[model samples]
Target: MASVSNPILVTGEPYTPGLTREAVCETYGVLVDEIAKLGSAENPLGPSPKALIAIAAAMGLTEQYPSWTAEPLRKAIAARYDVAPDEVVCGTGETEVISFIIRAYAGVGDKILMYRPCFPIYHLFAENEGRVPVYVDMGREMDFRVDAYVEALKSEPIRIAFLTNPHSPSGKLMAEADIRRICEAAGDALVVMDEAYIHFTETEGSLHLVKEFPNLIVLRTFSKAFGLAGLRAGFGIAAPEIIRPLWNIKPTWNMGHMQMAGAAAALTDHEHIRRTVDLIVEMRGYIAQRMSGLTAFRMVPGSRSNFFLIEVMDDRLDSTIVFEKLLERGVIIKDGSVSFRGLDKRFLRSDVGSKVNMDRLADALAAIEQSL
Candidate 1:
């Protein structure tokens, strides 16, 4: 047997730098009565009340193992997306399902294709599973060119293609034409569309495309709009043929009883999803508008998504420096420099938080500049 490296090692350091409790409270400035967390990309809005109720109800059933197939969640996902129950597979979260898909579909000598400065986990998992990950460049210039993706696929034996529509970090939305084109070009390869941020976008998602393409797998998570990251529940929608293998690859009774119940309840909470998405969109607009007025940083074009990137030209303050400075001031944002080697030290990424929280970030950055 040949020795192989673990793919999990490829991940960046949790993306959350260390922070003191006092520092966090100072930056967010939340009273004990109010909740304030702006670090993670999670929805600022809390979990749905329905999800809360379900989790409470599920507490009594904790002793039992979850259904072997997570049938209830699978059914709910299928109904929500207008797909057959068998066409859905519930996992601990979309990331776990992504791992299962990549590990099951490809291995040594196989290759995977995805864009650079993406979800990071895709690259991490590819390396762990002994697969080659080809990254296509994306940035302020070409709007994460789909043509490059097509060209890459044309030349590569791409076993799988992982795409984050309205991509993370850059928040660049892909045109419908591009998605259809990629689907057509992929041939037998499995196309995994990570739509974790889709709930924040106005554009329609590619979930429905599963009816037409067996190779298309849409990964959805409640972590964002539904505000259930803590629960760790997500699902995959695809043709029943594709979903079956994913189901086999998933851990037995993977999603706990509480998570399933919470996710199922969240699926029915239209008001929560709607209100949360509205808040994110509003905050995103606010960030874009504020950044537009500033000359110090290069602001990437905003999409209807919940995140964006800012490029700081000041060589003295790399994202890591800014990250540490923000930590001292009680704020936290992802450092794009580590994951995006193509990006200079000045690039840092932040997600849409509440207006107050975002304002604090803007003020902090301005203060940091003035101090420099």
Candidate 2:
């Protein structure tokens, strides 16, 4: 067969996920257990016990199909959020939900607005769908300003806007007031707040805002605090008016039997959620304190999520080199440059791990400072 290509299939640069255990072990010739596994912002303590039990029960149903619409799970999520079941919609993951939002609401040449250096998927999906990607640059300081976002929304003929709360990579938690301001100014455009890490913060999240902002959509995932990354479960919350269109386009049986089972069980595991959040917040504070003292690095402030960024202050040391040195010591973190837009300077992003694992990172950074 002859090779062929199509312009329609083209996309922006591919996403770079954090280092996996297998890759790190193979590259560094170390045991998988030796790596801190902090790169991806996964739950360090592990998956919810209830989710594990539910998966085992659902495993026997491999031959059967999932219940279309994931009705029961949707009700469970709705009950938790105190919203109607119809207001909730599930996806394979939040990313899929995001793509659905783009495809359902945006057409070719329609502008999909987001902050520069925000989640990469927003732009990548917009481009793949032939929609225009509109970025409002987050200045060199990368401050979280709702005014800048509101101005962009007011000025542009935007069809959809995706903003992250407790934003990824930088981990800046958006205050409810700021969120409210943006939503109010959004006018007729749909406001999508991707709160994939909101559980890690004190902010009740933009969930409450959805009740007032008919154009609002809040996206949540089970990957972090719920420790269900492998399950790929996510859902969206919005008024029926905003959700109806997404439902019209989403395929039936989009989620699987096991995913429904595990997610439904995980949602009820409040003890697990409490413990995970507590541990992460504790460790995050400890590491942030230690990381700040390192003269070579400056810890970015206002991080309410599980992960935070550290800028390399020394001109001699680049973030890419720091990532490699940490990997050599069996510590894995994401290089900040590839993580978000407007991050032109050298920086590194790390997630909260257990005390022992975090200590390993602290020691590695101390050594890296002297050598650098």
Candidate 3:
């Protein structure tokens, strides 16, 4: 018999998402509303009010197809970033855009550079397309070393390189200067700056870098700060030359009417965005301070995004133990032992949630510590 599927995908690991709120409810007998849901870095305050209104209003358009280009959403994104509409290419989500870039630029066996313990989509997409994923170590503490990355870029022929600003899992924000050095070293290779969580940080981010480096592409999403994750609306910005190919190859009407409408309205909701950022900032500090006294584990310092990592210090309790214990208390988070590639049992990633959610997590951890 002939082979029926791509061998790489047949053998490769699929991306593993965090446990859902309903899953916790089923397994632990917790109420659906009682779950803290600190696992998937969702907006603690929920979707923007304006976005919800827009989505409801656009419900009538469900029978008709959406714009082939997602023009309105693209224009809103362009105006927000000071980029041209033609320079933007919309997708169902940033993951779709990532797949598009991998498919368009890299051929089979081509090398795609990325940091170890990344978002996992980068590696998974490359493998799905039969491209090689080359990883640079993020160090034991998940620190980004520009020199090491630059060296890797120049080491061989790399077709594309993915850098996550305010990197995932760790949430450490890389400096602009360091990103510039990497772009300079990339030369002809395409550099993708995944800025999904950039809104959580104070920095202006690398959107401007797209103008400076023609080979650079900056990916943005309404999922994180804009609170439109369920809509799956995201776009990429780059030189018109790079975006043109992506636009041509992308599926027509990739974004639905509600996604386009909701995302566009969410972009204009500055107050909602501001409140979301303020909440993340406040709860992050609150949880950090609350967890400071725990002797079993310590919060990993220097995260500028909505989530941060907690490393279990006591040898008896690994990330798995802590993760299961938290689930028993209705506090859910990412267990590094299974979710992240390079991290071990000592680490877990927790999203900064509302005061109530953070309190649940802190209290759960304190109880676990007391038992230990």
- Top of the candidates by TM-score: 3
Winner on TM-score between 2 and 3 is 3
Q: Write out the backbone clash pairs for model 1.
A: 7-128
User: Mind giving the per-residue lDDT tens digits that candidate 2 earns over 1-372?
Assistant: 553342445534667788898898998987897888888889987899999999899899989887778887898999989999989889988988998899898888899888877878898778777898888776555667668788889898999988998887678877788888888888888899999999999567878888899989999999988999989999999998888777778887898888988999999999999999999889888888888778888778878889888788889889888888999999998887876655665888888889988888888888889886
Among these predictions, the greatest lDDT belongs to: 3
Every candidate's CA RMSD: 3.1, 1.8, 1.2
TM-score of each: 0.91, 0.95, 0.98
* Global CA lDDT computed for model 1: 0.79
Writing each residue's lDDT as its tens digit, candidate 1 over 1-372 gives: 654365445553343332334556666564432332454678777899999999999999989888878988888877877778888888888888998899788877699998877887887677767688898887454286788898888888999998998787677788777888999999999999999988888766998788877789999998888999889988888887888887788777788889989999999999998899889888888877776666556566756577778788677777888877766666667677775546667777777789987887777777787887
Weakest ten-residue segment in model 3 by summed lDDT: 1-10
Candidate 3 lDDT over 90-135, as tens digits, reads 9998989998999999989999999998999999889888999999
Assess each prediction's global lDDT (C-alpha) against the native. 0.79, 0.86, 0.92
Candidates, ranked, TM-score: 3, 2, 1
Q: Once model 3 is optimally superposed onto the true structure by TM-score, how far is the C-alpha of residue 332 displaced, in angstroms?
A: 0.7
